[model samples]
Target: MGIGDAQVSAEDLETVTQQLGRTPRGTRAIASRCPSGHPNVVQTDPRLPDGTPFPTLYYLTCPKLNSLVSTLESGGLMKEQTERLATDEELAAAYLRAHESYLAERDAIESLGTQVTAGGMPGRVKCLHVHVAHALAKGPGVNPMGDEALALLKAQELWPAGDCAETAAG
Candidate 1:
């Protein structure tokens, strides 16, 4: 879509409504879409309609992808990443870059006043869902931990490769 078309579309809103099972709050645009043309990642406003601070910039909406990431989280992937972050200086440095990038993206719209990025970035690893969403939205090489989690999911065949998006009629 072009810059003008970047604004949320009716189709995108409907798809996100279905993906979230409720009207999404603070949704600005569809950040990424599934193979079936359904919204998987969304770009949300820094603040909600009620003027509440919403730090999660990119939200993951696809149920299939959410389930896969949840499985990875339950399997101790987050703990593994946390451990890796403590031991691997290069990886930690890369994660710091990811944190900076996330802050830059969010502050471009509105400053959140703290370098603390979503999904426990910079010094720690938490919430694979958020990390995965960031990776999916920003693409690979942006978040090393997220990229690693996605790679693990793909190796386990848990990543969504086919179109599993739910249709309106379904």
Candidate 2:
């Protein structure tokens, strides 16, 4: 894939491609990097190369992070989050703001003409991977669910806050 104005180095794209096990489509930039200086997340275009209205703005690229998030999902984290959305008014409001922000950012590039945000934002927690990617890309406080997921990862000490990302890449 052509680097273009993706604002990412060729090496970064190469590493991301390897991590994803396939070429990325419409990658606009390296959205986030780990402490080891590897691309942990990427900012993808609203529309993919095939004209697909891709809503996932922040795509997590780290293999370790992906696996950790997958484990969290299998543990019924989404169910817990969804339940919270029904009872927690403050959290639900914050999540709605996060969804609006995500849509603004993506629509600034190209309008998707739909209100559908990634990771089931503004309602439920569908994918922790997308939440984590969003949190890592936009930083904490942007997505409460994403921040909570990262905290869980940190508690388990499975999050790659060091050379683990580099090691996984190589």
TM-score of each: 0.91, 0.91
Best by TM-score: 2
TM-score of 2: 0.91
- Residue pairs with colliding backbones in model 2 are none
Model 2, residue 112: C-alpha shift (Å):
0.8
lDDT of 1 by residue, 1-170 (tens): 21123689888888788888999999887787776667788888999999999989989999889988888889888888889888989999999999999999899999979787788887787788889888888889999977988898788776666555445355
Off by over 4 Å in 2: 1-6, 161-170
CA lDDT of 87 in candidate 2?
Answer: 99
- Candidate 2, residues 4-36, lDDT tens digits: the string is 335778988898999999998888988888877
Please estimate how well model 1 matches the true structure, expressed as its whole-model Cα lDDT.
Answer: 0.83
